[model samples]
Target: MRRLGPSDYRDMPWKNGGGVTRELLKLPHPSEPARFLARLSIASVAASGPFSVFPGIERTLLVLEGAGMALTLGGAPEVVLDRRSPPFVFPGEAETSCRLLEGPVRDFNLMVDRALVEASLEVVHLAPGGTRTVPGTGSVLLHGVEGRASLSGTPLAGEETLWLEAPGPLVLRSDEGARVIVIHLTRRESSSSGT
Candidate 1:
């Protein structure tokens, strides 16, 4: 397990130039935004605008702060998203954009190369003894977007993220008033290996 600080994350522009993204981590350190095996970042939706699309890259977004925003994906109906919203996009979608419903807001982003990988992310409210064991292959990232938590017995504060290499399982839990958003990233199993 490794801890990553928000102050250490890298920032870059979107391919379409709509907005900027603060890249947290990628398969290869310092990998370009347009090309990465798996990428994590945070975007500040300071203005109302359209979301830039990246074909073949599956995306999952969550509102980090502020009220929320309305999202339109391809021809699908617009959906209102806030700090409590979950991952909503899959691969092969046409267009995705957002318009601020109540001023500016912050959002978390996760994109992966679908052909070579798959991922799962969620925000769980943990009480005492509330623990989650995330399983993965290759690697996985656990970001504490909210309260304080621990991974494999190590403490993590808000905005701190952890990268776990290939292993059996990962543990997450909080003590006292800590609750965290757990993100689990993993490579997809090959069909040839047999389920």
Candidate 2:
């Protein structure tokens, strides 16, 4: 497994230009458009605001630092999320806005093309001993949310990520306790048949 660390994250302006977001990885790279399947990034929200819209995409956000956020999505009731809360999933096309709970907050985001990819995010409380195997199709992303860990023996520091394509039973182990974000992506839409 390969590792992407803090230094590898790309600093880019948000789609709405409200602030900047650090893009950790994009499946088709930063230059491609139509072929984008999955993307992972981190953004800091210093104030309450609206989120950038991305039609045909599904998004999940996990509070990595600070108090948390209260989100109003698609005319539904406002949902409050904190560091201990599970990741929130919503449609990218939905009208979404956020109200910070306390001060600024740092969050990790995962986006997948709704038409081509089905995605889910889960948090694992890892102990010092034992291995955690993540079974997935299409791709699996391991993010070290808190503390340090490893994927297939490759060291992943806090906030670092390891991307595995069509991964089988992947193993993760850590010497110290860790909090991990496991993103499972499966292909939902297919392309042309090989004829």
- Each model's lDDT comes to 0.74, 0.83
Pairs with steric clashes in candidate 1: 51-97
Provide TM-scores for the models: 0.84, 0.89
Per-residue CA lDDT of candidate 1, range 1-195, in tens? 677896789988866566678888877412345477778889877778878766778888888888999988778898998876777665535677788988878888888777666677777677766777766556667777767788777887888888777756777787754556566665566622533
Query: Clashing residue pairs, candidate 2?
Result: none
Best by lDDT: 2
Off by over 4 Å in 2: 15-17, 29-35, 192-195
Candidate 2, residue 46: Cα displacement in angstroms equals: 1.0
lDDT of 1 at 182: 60
Scored against the true structure, residue 27 in model 2 reaches a CA lDDT of 83
